[model samples]
Target: MESNGTGGEANAPENLLGTSPGASSLRSRTESECSDKLARFVLPSMDGSPPKVLTLNEVGDVLKNIQNMELVHEIAINPEFKFEPYEPPENSLERRIKDIMHKAFWDVLRGQLNENPPCYDHAIQLLAEIKDCFPQIISQNNTRALQHINEILDIDVIKQQAEEGVLDFRAYANFVIHLMAKSCAPARDELVRQLTEIEDVVDTFKNILETMALMKLDMVNYLLDFARNDIMANSVEYEKKKFKEYLEYYKFGFPATENWLKNSCIHDANNKPCSPEQTISNAYMELMDWDESKEFPEVLSIDKERILKLGQRAKRLCTCAAVISICSGVPVISQRTENRVALAKQIDIILQGTTNEKELLDSIENVWLQVKTVINEYLQKEDQPVIDANTEDMLKSQIMQTGNKDSPVRTLMWKRFQTYFRLAMRSRAGLPPPPPGYADFKDELEAYCTALKRVIAYNHSVFGEYFMKVLTQQRVTSTDTTTSAAAAAASATESVEPVSSSAAAVTEEKSVNSQ
Candidate 1:
């Protein structure tokens, strides 16, 4: 048995699909949720800020990529998607899996090929599977490659070659690689090279299978890119149909949406009724104040993860901006924009994936060093005197306190950011300017707001009719129940008159006896 070398895949994370920074998993979003309506995503903030549970539409730009995707199976139009080098999983479970997959299967095939008289049973099946991949990856117009595949990988000829002592596995592999090299896109040239250069027969074939998997992805993505224009053109109607099917499902409905809208609706200073659009927009904006204990409104649930991730992104920026605000409070770095940005980026890198105070404090020890370094760079660039030990100690003392939520500067900036969100949400006409002090997070706020507003406008345009239909039905049912209860109460009040009449007669008799 030959040893096949390997590596693992890197997780390609996004807030969600599409160019909008509201991240979502295109694949994951297609799943039906607990409400079993549309798929929902959970956006856990990297910093200690609150987790946002949102829906796929809330992720924004997904529908723009969500059309005629193999009739809703395996196509995505992600502008940000990139082809990355393949690496196999590196964990203990994956090691066991790798052993079973490669050691047990490929080794058995190799062992069978090298056995007395050469068994063609397993080899033929393996070749058959490999044969299937060619048609999947290549075009029908490439008649030369198709004809070559038939000649080389023909099961009858391969079986006959095995019957004689003349089977050459390397010849089949070389021939396939020759065609793969020709067919593969430029991005996959390296993969094709890796497939060609592997010396061991088993390694060569394993690399072949791996490279083919990547090639198929490359082809699909290329197809997706080519098809993206068509996808965007037709996405709205396709998404509407799919969402209608979800709504039509007997068990699935937007039970939470009616209440979410009803609760989030507000009156102006004059107590005038808000327009329906205002009502819906206000409801979506209220998601920023989400409570973890409750479920997201069903309408928003599908994009729950994307919306939350966008919120998380916004929160992460705010958190980082606050830290920079604190670090730069030393006057030298505070006055300079570059120093704050550089220092904040370094701190964010250090603080990545931290979800709470304890985890945050663990990394604070290194932040002081980042702060000092950034300050020194700024001073050197500007030809200012470098900081003394007293200044360094003062900066370190200030920086370390950021691990706490109440670090005064951090809290102050956070409050300003919160104020900004509320002010933005209050009303477009009467929207107040953002609270000052957290200006560094302005870009984050803008990006999140843009994605949210876009998602809201697009989602409402597509689904508002359906939303109103459900809301109307729910309201009618509620009003009917209320009317029935009022009728029952009125009947009980009519029956109570007899008891009052009897009490009145008893009081008259008592009054006559006393006279």
Candidate 2:
């Protein structure tokens, strides 16, 4: 392959000397230029004195070492080796083998980079090429892998840093090595299986693996150090990059209809002057003023953007209701005009202080508890005869209980109420009513809400599961340490007892003889 002009093989002595007769002068010129370039590639020593310039011989040796390393890497991931079928080792053996293989891989990588720093670019390129050998290594799709790579090695950032002469090639190389290991896991596993099967080479493989694992860890530390320094040095710039990426996924500004609530209050159905508060208050009242002849308003909407906004509002309302009910020890009356007014006021207050998505979601969870309370109350009343208004109020006052906040029933009720509240509010006076084919739109909206809830719930559950796993691991580790310590103490006591008994026996014998 032709040199990439970054001083790979182009400056090799053999390449420089092996020129045509007519190009003897050109060869000498090239040699002189290469020597000058090699001199400029001065690496600083640990003692931080004068930088050490590479001699032609040292450069040749470095290039040779890099070539040999690349050759070994290629051989390790050879198609023939990867395709060789072999029985996997037993579970215990497999774990050991895996650990060893990882160590070996990383050790070689670290040494290769440290010895020949200029080979960093080639090493990274080789890793990218090797990734293609094991297509099934990463669980995520290729697109996602590309996106992850792009994020870590943003080309713009690289260019900017390079121009500024502050680019850390070693850190970048470590990151690439880490990625290569990850991408080559399947291939490595296969190779490990084959190696472990061979008794003669097992020890060598284990040694290699151990080295690689240690090197991989070092690489991780190095990358982390780089990130720490970079963040500390350019905090604002780092944050700007992060924020720019986040904005690409989620829009920053509120929707166009963000003022829907305010607008609802300003105009009546006829576009006449009206009290926005009163209009909103009456809309809540109309939720319970259901007529037997009039069909229920479509509970779904097709306009996803609009529905999303409505969902946000509904979530806010639910949260406000929950907080109020929890704090005041009052059963949230969804239909009462006064309650709706109170909810709106609470929502306003909540919104005023809310600064992030997390806060908003937390608020919604609070309201979800109240919804659960109401649902449970209704379920309990299912078998009982219809109580009079006064009797119902008495029952509510006496028996209303705040159940487990994380109850599944609460989540279900919360979801149902989310849809109901969104539909009801959207149909409010002065607001745009559900468009034509409202029924289908309502179905679509409900589906959208259900899917959204599922995604949120799934994410929450994943985090919860991870947290539990970490706690369990910590507990297990603590228990193991305690048990080991106890066992050691007991063993020590047993050993000391024997010695004590022997000493006592000797003393008794001596005493008897003396007597």
Candidate 3:
């Protein structure tokens, strides 16, 4: 048997063979149908070009678009979709949170100011105020520099430039600074030289002031001693009158004689002396000539009052010095007396108005510490005796009046002294000595610290603790009820609830039912 031209097998004759050809052709047709079905679903490009295989990114984009379309369809169909207005909390918690934030911001600003003080705004304001004062400090030749400063300070021009965002004042500020520095160069150099020349100017000044105070005391004492001696010697009226006159003149000046005669003598209603007895009395009194009687004469009256006044003044000054010494951590009493004498001389020079700024600057170097130490030591040694004597007189008077041995007055005085002494000692203890040959206007530092303490009575540690407590208190109070409720719920769930098998089974059943 022979095959046909189209490769189709011919049917077998009645007497011929066994296999069918259609089975092979059926398998090939099934494969072709599957390929055609797949080709029918292939997508074409937007430009009507042949279909191209999509990349992974393009497929992801198509999936995202389909998800967006489904979301839009769901929103359109849903009837419960409603936009709600957002409501702000109406409670103290919001206010408290704001306050805490405000406090924190101010604290940070304060710290910044402390770290780098004299900020640009303050510096500019200061410059404006002291513009006129600069002329006196600087030389006439610096007029051009002054003009430049004035030009730079023009508010209108500055504002215009600032609006245009081209304002740059740094160069102008630097120029002014350099000019002023140059102008003050001579004064600054002079001060520096004096500081270098003087070994310890502050110590010298303190010593001088202390010695002058002591000398004043000694002079008064000598006057008293002379008066006592004259009275004991039974000096002649002429000599006594002369001594009395000197005391009166010293205490009250020349007007004392006229005033005393007019007041003490017998006078007419017109206040004029009329009798010879009045004249004699006036003459003798004016001369301060008087015999000491059992009552003790009034010849030394003015001197006594003057002494008391001087003593009180000295005591007050000593007290102030002692306080400053304790605060400054410097010993007032130096080992050497020569330093005290030098200090006294320097003070005299200053009082005479002959001392220039350079000399004054030199004396001011570490002055607070030096003055404190010197005054403290002087009070301890010299002024203490006077204070004790005064205190004794007061005690005597109180005793005579109340007849009480244990008075509250005495206790109060004792307590004050104890406190003062304790503070003084504490200030001195463990303080390092100032560096050798180092000098500056330490009084400025003392003044600054005093001002700071006046404003803020509490120390840094106390202030910090208080500030933190305030912030924490606010934070605690500001915590919302919702947060508290949530915390409470969590605690309750943890304490009493356990994940038992029965509970788990119940939860699963509910989920299955919901599904």
Lowest summed lDDT across 10 adjacent residues in model 2 is found at: 19-28
Task: Give a tens-digit lDDT track for model 1, residues 335-371.
Answer: 7776666666677787777654577677777777777
Models sorted by lDDT, best on top: 1, 2, 3
Which whole-number lDDT from 0 to 100 does residue 470 have in model 1?
55
Candidate 3 regions with alpha-carbon error over 4 angstroms: 1-127, 130-133, 139-142, 185-515
Question: Candidate 2 at 510: error in angstroms?
Answer: 30
State each model's CA lDDT, in order.
0.65, 0.42, 0.36
- For model 1, give the 10-residue run with minimal summed lDDT: 1-10
Give lDDT tens digits, candidate 2, residues 209-252. 34344434444444444455443345333323433332232222
Better lDDT candidate (2, 3) = 2
Backbone clashes, candidate 3: 7
Candidate 2 lDDT: 0.42
Per candidate, the number of residue pairs that clash is 20, 13, 7
Deviation in angstroms for 21 in model 2? 55
TM-score per prediction, in order, is: 0.64, 0.17, 0.19
